[model samples]
Target: MLERWSRGLKGLGNWTAGVMDAFYGALGTPGKYLQDFLNGSWLGHPLHPVLTDVVVGGFTMLIILDLVSLIFGANFRDPSLIILGLTTLAGIATILSGLTDFKDTATGDERNVTTLHGYTNVASILIYAIAFFVRLGGSETTGQILAIIGYLVISVGAFIGGHVVFKYGYMVNHNAFSRGRRAKEFTPIMPAVELAENTPTKAALGPTALVLVRRGDVVYALKETCSHAGGPLSEGQLQGGAIVCPWHASHFRLSDGAVVHGPAHTRQVAYRARIQAGQVEVEGPVG
Candidate 1:
C-alpha cells in the first residue's frame, strides 16, 4: 500500500530535479559547502533528523499547552503562540536541510520515497505557518483548530519520513553492518604485480571487500563500499590524496579513509597494506 503510494510519487522526482539542479548550480562551490554542513559532514551524522526532533517536540508541547488551556480555564495563549512560531521556524530549517540531503539521492525508489516524505513535511509546515498567522490575528479557537490539524499532518509526515529511513535505508551509514574490527595479522589479497600504480582496484578478505590503491612502493586500502551510499569505491577516481566516490563525489583520504567531503559523514573503513612475498597483504583499520 505504502509502496504503491511511493511509486505514485516517483513523477515528482522528474518535476523537481531541474529545479533542484538550478538551485544547486546557483549556489556552486559555496552551496557544496553548505550542503556538507547540512548533511552533517562535520557532525558525522545526519542533521535533518536532529532538526525534525526539535520541530516535533515543539509541536507536541504546543498541543499539550492547548489542551491545558481548553480543559482548565488557564490563559496559555501567549505560550502556545510562541511555541507555534518556534516550531514553524524549526520546520523551515528542517525542510532546507532535508532538501540539501535529498539532492544526493541516486535511485528512483529512494527518490520516490523522499518525494513523498519531503512534500508531506512541506504541507505540514504550511499548515503550521497558517495557524501561526491566524493566532496572531486574534482568533484563538480557530487558531487552535488549525494547530491541531497541523499536528495531525505533521504526524503523518513523520511516519513517512521514518519509512524512508527504516524501510528504504536512506541516509544510513553503508558500513554500519560491518563489525569494523581490524584484522589481527596481514592477509594476502592478490599478487602485488597485478595492482596498477595509482589505480583503484578491488580485492576481498573473506566477506569484506577492499579497494587498494598503489602509490610507488606503498599500497593504500579502504573498504570497497562507500560509507554514504554503498557506491563501489574501487570504481571511483583519485583526487590528490583522496578517492572520490563515482556515485556522489564523496572524497575519502586514501591513506586513512577519513572523509574529506560529504554527503558521506562517516569515514570509510581503512586498512594497513604491505607487500609480502609476491602478494599484497592487508590488515588493521590502521588506527
Candidate 2:
C-alpha cells in the first residue's frame, strides 16, 4: 500500500508538472524576467533555493522559540508575533521566487518535478498563512495550535524541496559530476595528427567528452561542451586556438578550455593528447 501510494504521488506530481510546464511556457517574457530573478543572476546563485532555505529556516526557528518559551515559562507573545509576521513575508517571497525559477525550466521531468514541488509548496504556504492569521487573531492557547500546525506544513514543504534538489540535482553545475575521480590524471593516448587540423574529434575519457583540435603539429583536447549551457564547443568557430560557442559566442582556449568571454565563467575541461598505435586517443576530464 505504501509503495502504491508513493507511486501514485509521483504520478500526480508528473501530471501537475505537465500542466504547469504548459502554463509557464506560455507566459513568455513575464516568465523570463521571473526566471532570471529565481536563478539569482543578481546574487550569483540560485535565489529560489536560497530563499527556500530562508523561509523554511524561519519556521524552524519558530519551533525553537516554542521550545524556549515552554522551558523558560517566559512570555514569547511579542517575539513570536514578530517571527510569525516575518515568516509570512518570507513564505510569500519563496512562492514568488519559485515561480521565476519554474519559468526557465525545460519542459520535461524537471518541469514535472518542479510542478509537484510547486503544488506542495503552495499548499503548505496556504496552510502556514492561515496558521499565521489564526495566531494573530486568537489568544495564547490558539497561538500554540497555530504554531504547531504551521510547523507541520513547513516541514512537509521542506522535505519535498529537498527531494526536488537532491534527487533531481537542480541548480547544480551540470558538469560538476561529469568529472570522474581520474580527471587530474592527464596522459595522451593518441597522436595529434589523428584529429583533422581544424576539425575536432571526440573521445570519451572516463565520462567526460573530449574534443580535439590540431594546429600544424601541436594537438590539444578540451571539453566538448560549452560550460555555460552545454553547447557543443567543438562545433564552434576557432579563433587563435580558442573555440567560440556557436550558440552564445562563449569562447574557450583549445590548449585548455578556459573561458574567454562572459556568460560562462567556468572553464572547460582540457586534456592531454597523444597517439597509440594507429588509433589517436586523448585523456580528458575525469567522469
Q: For candidate 1, what is the lDDT? A: 0.89
Give the Cα lDDT of each candidate: 0.89, 0.64
Please write out the lDDT profile of model 2 over residues 1-287, one tens digit for every residue: 22233443565655554554576568865754444455564454567777777877877777788788889987777777788788778888888777655544444565566666676678767766776777777666676676677677667667766776777665544566664325444455455445787776665565566677776656677777665567776677887868877765556777766655523446677776655554555654522
Model 1 residue 46 CA deviation in Å? 0.6
lDDT of 1 by residue, 1-287 (tens): 66678888777765776576678779999977887898888888999999999999999999999999889979998889999999999999999889878878865777887888899889999999999999999999999999889889899989988988998778899988883556889988899999999999998877888999999889999999999999999999999999999998899999998888888998899999998898999898766
The parts of candidate 2 lying over 4 Å away from their true place are 1-34, 42-45, 70-72, 104-110, 180-207, 210-222, 225-287
What is candidate 2's CA lDDT for residue 188?
52
Listed per model in order, the count of residue pairs whose N, CA or C atoms clash below 3 Å is: 0, 9
Estimate candidate 2's alpha-carbon lDDT, on a 0 to 1 scale.
Answer: 0.64
TM-scores, all candidates, are 0.94, 0.59
10 residues in a row with least lDDT, candidate 1: 13-22
* TM-score of predicted structure 1: 0.94
Q: Best by lDDT, which number?
A: 1
